[model samples]
Target: MTPADLTCTVLGAVRRAVEEGALGGAVAVPDRVKVERPRPGGSGDYATNAALRLAREARLPAREVAEVLSAELTRHPGIAGVEITGPGFLNITLAHGSRDALVRDTLTNILTSGSGYGQGRALSGQAVELRHRAEVRAAVTADAVRRLLEAQGALVRIDAYEDEAAGPVPAPTPAPGPAPTATLAYEPSPVPAGATAHELHRRFGTDATRWALLRAAAHDRPRLDDGLLVQKESNPFFLVRYAHARSRALVRAATRLGFTAGYEEDAAALGDHPALLAALGDHPAVLASAARLRAPDRVARHLETTAEAFLGFQHTVLPVGDEKPSAAHRSRLALAEAAGTVLAGGLSLLGISAPEYL
Candidate 1:
C-alpha cells in the first residue's frame, strides 16, 4: 500500500477507537494522520505517532494508547503486524504479498496516468509565486519548483528577479484561512569551480548539465566535470539512464520469448527483491515529499536509488539462457517497467530526457 493508504488506515483506526470509547468519549480524532517511512534503526516499513498524539486527550499513557490502536489496526488485512517503539510510535509491517500488490498497483497507475501518476492535491487551492535570478542555475531551479508546485495542485507564477521590481516587503501577511497562498524566493546554488552553464553544457550536453545542476541540494555547490559525461556505472546520470534503457531492453527480450509484462500477487516473486520493490512502492511518496519541500534534488536522488535497485534486480527479470519465460518473469518484467516509468517521470520533472537507449 502507498503511504496515503496507510495514513487513511491509521486515521480509520483512530476513529474506531474513539467511537468505541476505548480512547474515551471526549477524545478527539484528528481529521488526518501521518504515516511515514521508519527512521534509521527503526523497525518495520512505516511508522506513525498517532497514539502519542492522542495520549494526552485519551488520558492514558502513550504506550497504552499505542496498545489500543495496535489491537484495532491489527484487524486490517493490509497490515501484517504493529510494534510499539520508543514511547509510543507504531511501527507497522504490511502483509507478505504487499510488495507484489504495490508493484501491481504502481504499474497499473503509471500505465493509466503516465506522467500524472504522482500528481497530488497536497497543495490544492493554493497559489505560489516563485522569484529567481536570471542565472541559468537559478532559472532552472525556479522552473523545476514551478513544476513541482503545479503537480501538487498549486497555481504557480514564476518571475525572474529584477532590481527595479525589488521593493520594501509588505508588513502584514494574509490572514490565516483556507487556501493560503505563498511567495517564495529561491537562491541558486554556486556553480562548480566557477564554471559557467554555457561551458558545462558545451562540455557535458544539456541532460548532463541539468542533472549536474539539480542533483545537489540548493545549499550545496554543483560540479561540472568530465565525470558527468562518463557512460559508466560510476556516473550517476549514466546509471539512471542505463537502468531505464535496461528496463526497456528487458521488455523487448521478454516479448521475443513470447511473454509480456503482467502482474500476479505472488509474494515469492518479490521475496528476494525487497529493495527494488520498496523503491518502486516509494515513488509516489518521494514525489509528494519533493513537491512539498520544493526539493527537486530529492527526486533526483530518488531516481538514483531506484536505478540502483532496478539495476541490481534486472538480471533476474527474464530467463537467463535456454529457460522458458514464466509467470514469474512476467511479473518481474512489470515491476521493472514500473521502475522505468518512475525514472522517466522523475527525469521529466527535472527537465531532463530519459532516452530509450542510453
Candidate 2:
C-alpha cells in the first residue's frame, strides 16, 4: 500500500478504538495521520508517531497508547508486523508480498495516468495573477509559476512589465524538439548578459536554457554556462534528462526481448528499493507544495532526487548478460517507467523538455 493508504488505515484504527471505548472518546483524533519512512537504523517500511500525538488526548502514556493502536493495526491485512519503538513510534513492515504489490500498483497508476499522475485540483477555483519585471529570470520564473499553478487547476494570468530600459526584453525562442501540445502564453524576457536570445538558444538549446533559468531560486543568479550542456551526473539537468532517456531505452530493450512490464508479487524479487518507491509516492505532495509556494526550484530539486534514486536502481531494472528476463525485471522496468513519467511531467511544468533521446 502507499503511505497515504497506510495513513488512512491508522486513522481508522484510532477511530475504532475510540468507538469501542478501548480509548477515551474524548481523545482528539487528528485530522490527518502523518506516516513516513523510518529513519536510519529504524525498523519497518514506514513509521508514525500517532501514539505520541494522541497520548495526551487519550489520557494514556505514549507507549500504552501505541500498544492499543498497534493491536488494532496488526489486525489489518498486508501488515506483516508492527513494532512500538522508542517514545511510542509505531514502525510498520508490510507483508512479504505487499511491497512488490504496492510498487506494482504505484507504477501502474503512474503509467495509466500518464502526465496527469500528480495533477490535482487543490487550487481549483483559485485565480492566481502573477506579475513580474521583464528580466530574463523574472520572465522564466513567472512562466514556470504559471504552469505550476495551472497544473493544480488554478486559473493563472501572467503579466510582465515591458520597460526595455529597465532590462533587455527576453526574445521568444522556439522550444526544442516537437511543438508543445499545450502552449502557455509567455512573453520572453531579455536574454541574459546582453546576448541575443537566438545566440543563447543556439548556445544552450531550449531544454538547457530553461533548466538553467528555472533550476535556481529566483533571487539567485542562475549559472548560464557551458557546464549545463555537459552529459554527466555533475549537471543536474543532464542527470534528470538522461535518467528519463535511460528509462525509455530500457522499455525498448525489453520490447526486443518480447516482454512488457508486468506486476510482480515476490518480495524477494522486489528486494530493498524503498528509496525509489518513496520518491515516487512523495511526488504528488511535492507538486502541491511547489504550486502553493510558487517555487519551480522545488520541482527541479525533486526531479534531481528522483533521478538519483532511479540511477541507483537502474542496474537492477533489466537482465544482464546470460540472466533471463523475470518478473523482477518487469517490475523494475515499471518502476523506472514511472520515474520517467514523473520526470517528464515535472519538466513540462517547468516549461522544459524531457527528451526520450536525450
Candidate 3:
C-alpha cells in the first residue's frame, strides 16, 4: 500500500485510543503525524516517531508508549509488523504486495484524470483564454483543442480558419504591427477533409507510446541525421505534451493559491490574464510561442504559447525582503510550480516529455 493508505490506519487507531481514554491523558497530542520511507538497512519499510512525540502528553515512558502504539498497528490489515526502537520510534512493515494495489490504483487514477493526473488546483475552469498570435498556429491549436474537447465530451464552438487546409495565407510581415495583417489574405474555410486524427495517429503517432517514442528515439531507436526526426511526426506530439503539462500545473497551483482550477474537483477560479512578454521572466518558451504560431504546423506553433506561459511562470519572486519568500511569494511559487506541473502533464497526455528541469 502507499504511505497514505498505511499511515491513515495507524493515525486513526491513535486518535481512537486517545478518545477512548486507553492512554491516560488530560489532553491529546495536538500534532501532525508523519510517515516516511525507512532509512537504508532499517528494519521496517516506514517509520514514525509519533509515539515519542506523544509520550510527554500521555504522561508515560516513550518506550511504553511505543509498545502500546505497536500493538495497535499490527491489528490492522495490510500491516505485517510494527516494532518499537530508537527511544520509542515506531516502524511498520507492510504486507507482501500491498503496494501493487496502490500502484494499480495510482495508474488508474492517473489515466482517469487525463492531463490532470497529479495536477494541483491553481486554476480550474477559470475561463482560461489563450490568445493565438500566428494564424497557422492558432488554426492548428484550435483544431487540436476542438478534437480533444470533443473527445472528452466537452461542448466546444469552433471558428472557421481563413487559411483552410494549409492553403497559402498571408506571408509573414517584415515588421510587427497591429495584430497581424497579411499582404494578401485568404481563408477558404475548407470542409473537414483528408486523414482523420486517428489515421494521423496511426501513421505518425507510432503507438500508444507516441510521446515516449520521443524519448525512445534518443536511445533504443536507430539514429538519424542530426538526431532530427521528421518535423511532421515529432511536432504534434510535442504540442500535445506541452499543453497538458501547463494545464495540469495551473490547476494545482490554483489549488495551493486558495483558488480552484481543475477539471476534477471544485476548488477556485482562474483569471483570464494575458501572460505579458515583458513579465515572462525566464520563460523563453512563452516568447517562442508568441513568435512561432504562424508556421505550417499549427499544432507545434500553438504549443509554444502554452509552453512559454509555463516557462515564464517557473519561479515568481517578489520585491519583499527581510522575510523568507512572502505569503504572496509562497502562493506565487505554488502557482509557478503548478505551471510547470501542468505543462509537463499536458505534454504527457499528448505523448510528449515534460522535462523535470527545463
RMSD of each: 5.3, 6.6, 22.8
Tens digit of lDDT per residue, candidate 3, span 230-346? 333234444434444444555454455455322221111112212421122212222222222211122233345545554454434232334443444443443444444434544
lDDT of 1: 0.79
lDDT of 2 by residue, 50-76 (tens): 999999988899999999999999999
> How good is model 2 by TM-score?
0.80
lDDT of each: 0.79, 0.79, 0.44
| Candidates arranged by lDDT, highest first | 2, 1, 3
* Per-prediction TM-score: 0.87, 0.80, 0.35
Where does the lowest 10-residue lDDT sum fall in candidate 1?
A: 164-173
Instruction: Give residue 126's error in model 3 in angstroms.
Output: 16
Judged by lDDT against the true structure, how good is candidate 3? 0.44
**lDDT score, candidate 2, position 228:** 85
Cα lDDT for residue 44, candidate 1: 85
Q: After superposition, which runs of candidate 1 have C-alpha atoms over 4 Å from their true positions?
A: 97-100, 161-193
lDDT of 1 by residue, 1-358 (tens): 7777889999999999988999998898898888877877678888998998999988999999999999999999989999998999999998866645665676788767776778777777677777766466766776777777777777667666543222222222222236654654444443433455566667888788788888888878876778998889989999999999998899888888899888765767767887787776777788889888888999999999999999999988988878888888888888888888888888988888999986
Backbone collisions counted per model: 0, 4, 42
